[model samples]
Target: MTTVRIPAGWPATEEQARAVQDELRERVVTDEPGPPPRTGQVTGVDVAYDDERDVVVAAAVVLDAADLTVVAEATAVGTVSFPYVPGLLAFREIPTVLAALDALPCRPGLVVCDGYGLAHPRRFGLASHLGVLTGLPTIGVAKNPFTFTYDDPGIPRGSVSPLRADADEVGRALRTREGVKPVFVSVGHRVTLDNACAHALALTPEYRLPETTRRADALCRRALREATA
Candidate 1:
């Protein structure tokens, strides 16, 4: 795997966040109707933090895109080099995610992350950051919205609401399973908004979260647990 360089000195500050957002928006594809994806295999990425150490423990879980079953897993450990800024979380985890993805024996068709995407204040969340760095089709599915606003989908699972920023549609807040909280779905890169939702929905199997995310979350916890043990 090729090493993707992280742009040094990214503003972890609010001013920097805005600047980077503009840069990212200009760099990212916002054109209508992206090209059809020809590849397969969807991967889920999740992070478990060691609060005391301020370290990021993460996992990447690859699944059969058609069947949504786990096929491979990779783990990574790294420091949160960036601060916990509201819209700049991609800086905190992109390196660790790249490390973990690099360790995977096989490449993935799509990557779904536990964060926001085009719905971000700067439109460059973790998903977009990693997607741009890796040139991968990625989606951001967050349990909660960051700065974007929309009507709640309510308690019923499978309900959805549009995530709008500045009175424009950025993404969707989807309820995957009943009674569980909804997740915000947004396009990261090289993927359409509808395709992002399709990938997320296809990975669900009687769970509030996608199969990939569930697997990665469990893997992340296991990594943290084993490392601490």
Candidate 2:
């Protein structure tokens, strides 16, 4: 595990954070198709918070894209840099997440964030922010669609529907299992929306959530417990 500290001059107000978001949002790439599914390495990144302690723990778990076997993992604990604000939650987690990813032994080919990307109200979320900073391909596989509206997808595995904000389609609600609630997938950086959905499905072969997410989630929570203890 690694320890991280908030950078100097980190945003202290919502206005400052939103200004940063607006500037960085323009740097997010959306043209590249990114790496193909079931190839190279795919990493899942998640964070756990202990608000009372003002601490957050982040975990990054890299898996072989073909078989979903764990290749490498790292964790970082840090002071929460920002308060719990909806749509701006990434600021609280990114520093620790960056430390965790930096500690990994090998390259993280495609990063999967357990949060939003283009599906965000500002069109820039954790995955996009991480990608822009690290120059890595990334996508978001979120459990909920945030404020986006979507029609129900078919009751079958691999079915999908557009997640819309008003008239613009921002992402997809992708069903990874039959009769299960779909996961929301969106382009983060260097990836298209269709490819993002495909990667989400490829990662979720056995459950509603991807193995990468499941592993990272558990590891982050464990790291948080250990840090707080």
Candidate 3:
């Protein structure tokens, strides 16, 4: 696998991080609502890192978005090249994710990521990185906001919030299931935020995260754990 160096201590200087983020914001593709998405399969992609072995594990899990059942699952492993910078997360995880996608037995209609989408500082988070790299439609569902801020819309589930980077509304924060924490939803590529949020909601019935992320995250952890065990 190809590699890119992360800075010595991992995280970047605040200034350097901000610069990269500003560059990303300039490249945002903010068009209006488009055509409807076809009813099709959706996949979840996630990564778990093991610093001791300098390894990254990726998982891709496809599911029936309408029914929330697994269709296919794949896992891949690779080295971590980049350091863990706050905003520049895509560079570190995407390589392994591609490997995970390559191992998939079936192609998914779309991908839901456990990271950022347009909610990123550059407006291109993990979903955007993976989508463009693989040319697949993707959305990001993150547990926390990186550089974006918004109201939490209270709890009780299904509460919605608009994510703002500075002052611009980039995406929406969605609660997947009742009593579950909200996941930030944004358009990563070839999709709209609304569509992405709808897809995420359709794939969830239990837990805080959508089934794809929940399962894929588990798969990635298992892959790394079993390998090092």
Candidate 4:
């Protein structure tokens, strides 16, 4: 596990964080199709927090896209860098997540964040922020739709419905398993919305959540427990 420290100029107020987002959001690439699904490696990133202890733990797990086998994993623990703020949660987690990704032994081809991307109210979420910083193809596979509205997808696996913010189709509600609740997917950077949903389905061959997310979530929680112990 790596230990992380908040950068010297890290934002301390919501205004400052929003200003940073405003600047970075313009750099997020949307035209690129990114890597094809089921090729190269895909990584999942998640963070666990111990608010009372002011500790955050982040985990990154890379899997072979073809078979979903784990290729590499890394964890990082850091001080909570920012207070909880709606739509700005990425600021609290990104430092530790970047550290965990940096500690990984293999290249993370496509990063999947257990959060939002273009589906965000600001249209820039954790996945999008990470992608812009690393210049990696990334996507978000979220458990909930946040504030977005979407019609329920069909009962069958692989069905999808547009996740809408007013009139704009920001993402998709993708059914990964028959009769299971769908996962919300959105383009982060260097990937299209369609390909993002395709990759979500490919990673979720056996469950409602992708193997990459399941693994990283568990690892981050474990790392948090160890850090607080």
Candidate 5:
């Protein structure tokens, strides 16, 4: 595990954080189709928080895209970097996440965040922020739609419904397993919404959530327990 410290000049208020988001949001690349599914590496990143202790633990697990086998993994623990502001939650988690990613032994390739991307109210969520900062192809696979509205996807696996904010199609509600609740997928940086959903399906051969998310969630929670203990 790596230890992380909040950088000097990190956002100190919601206004500052939003300002940072507005600036960085313009840099998020949405045109390019990212790496093809089932090729290269796909990394899942997640964070676990102990609010009472002010500790946050983040994990990054890289899997071989073709076979979904683990390739490399790393964890980082640090103080929570920001207050819990709804749309600005990225500020609380990014420092340790970046540290965990930096600690990885190999390139992360396409990153999948267990949170939002363009589906956010500000249209810049954790995945988008991380992608702009790292210049990596990134996507978000979220369990819930946040404040967005979406029609239920079809009951069959691989079906999708558009996740909408007003009239804009911001993401997709993707059914990765038949009869299971769909996961929300969105473009973060260089990836398209379609490819993001495809990647989500490719990563979820046996569950509603992607393997990257499932593995990283478990790892981060485990690291948090060990850190607190």
Candidate 6:
């Protein structure tokens, strides 16, 4: 595990954080179709928090895109960089996540975040922030569409509906399993929305959540427990 420290000049208030978001949001690339699904290494990044202890633990698990096999994993623990805030939650998580990713032994080809990207109120979420910082092809596979509206998809695997913000389509609600609730997918950076959803499906061959997410989520939670214990 890597240890993390809050970067100097990190956003100290909601206004500062939002200002940072506004500036970085403009840099998020949405034109390119990222790496083809299931072709290269794909990594899942997730964080666990112990608010009472002011500790955050982040995990990055790299998987072989073709077979969903784990290739490398790293964890980082740090003081929570920011206070609890809704849309700005990424600020609290990003520092340790970057540290975890930096500690990884292998290159993380396409990163999958267990949070939002373009499907955000500010149109810049964890995945987008991380992508812009690392210049990686990244996507978000979220369990819930935060404040967004989407029609229920068909009761079959691979079904999808547009995740909308008013009239503009921001992301997708993708059904990875028959009769299952859809996972929200969004373009983070250097990836198209369609390709992002395709990668989400490719990562979910066995579960409603992507294997990358499932594995990283478990690892981060465990790391948090160990750190706190």
lDDT, candidate 2, 1-229, per-residue tens: 7889999988999999999999988888999999999999999999999989898999999999999999999999899899989899888889899999999999999999998888999999888999998999999999998999999999999999999999999999999999999999999999999899989999988899999999999999998898899
Q: What is the lDDT of candidate 2?
A: 0.93
Flag regions of model 5 displaced more than 4 Å.
none
Model 6 deviation from native, Cα RMSD in Å: 0.7
The regions of model 6 sitting more than 4 angstroms off are none
Question: Of the pair 2 and 6, which is ahead by lDDT?
Answer: 6
lDDT of each: 0.77, 0.93, 0.75, 0.94, 0.95, 0.95
For candidate 1, write residues 69-160 as lDDT tens digits. Answer: 67888898876667777777877777778888988989866888998878887677888877777878788888887777888786676678
Candidate 2 matches the true fold with a TM-score of 0.98
Tell me the tens digit of each residue's lDDT in model 6 across 120-162.
9999998999999999999999999889999999999999999
> Which candidate do you rate higher for TM-score, 3 or 6?
6
How close to the true structure is residue 151 of candidate 1, measured as C-alpha lDDT? Answer: 85
Candidate 3 per-residue C-alpha lDDT over 183-213 given as tens digits, one digit per residue, 9 for 90 to 100: 8888887787777777766666667788888
**How does residue 196 of candidate 4 score in lDDT?**
95
Error of 5 at 19 (Å): 0.2
lDDT of 5 at 35: 98
Tens-place lDDT per residue, model 4, 79-105, is 999988879988999999999999999
TM-score of 6: 0.99
Q: What is the C-alpha RMSD of each candidate to the true structure, in Å?
A: 3.3, 0.7, 4.1, 0.7, 0.7, 0.7
What TM-score would you give candidate 4 relative to the actual structure? Answer: 0.98
lDDT of 5 by residue, 1-229 (tens): 7899999999999999999999998898999999999999999999999999999999999999999999999999999899888899899999999999999999999999999999999899999999999999999999999999999999999999999999999999999999988999999999998889889999999999999999999999999999999
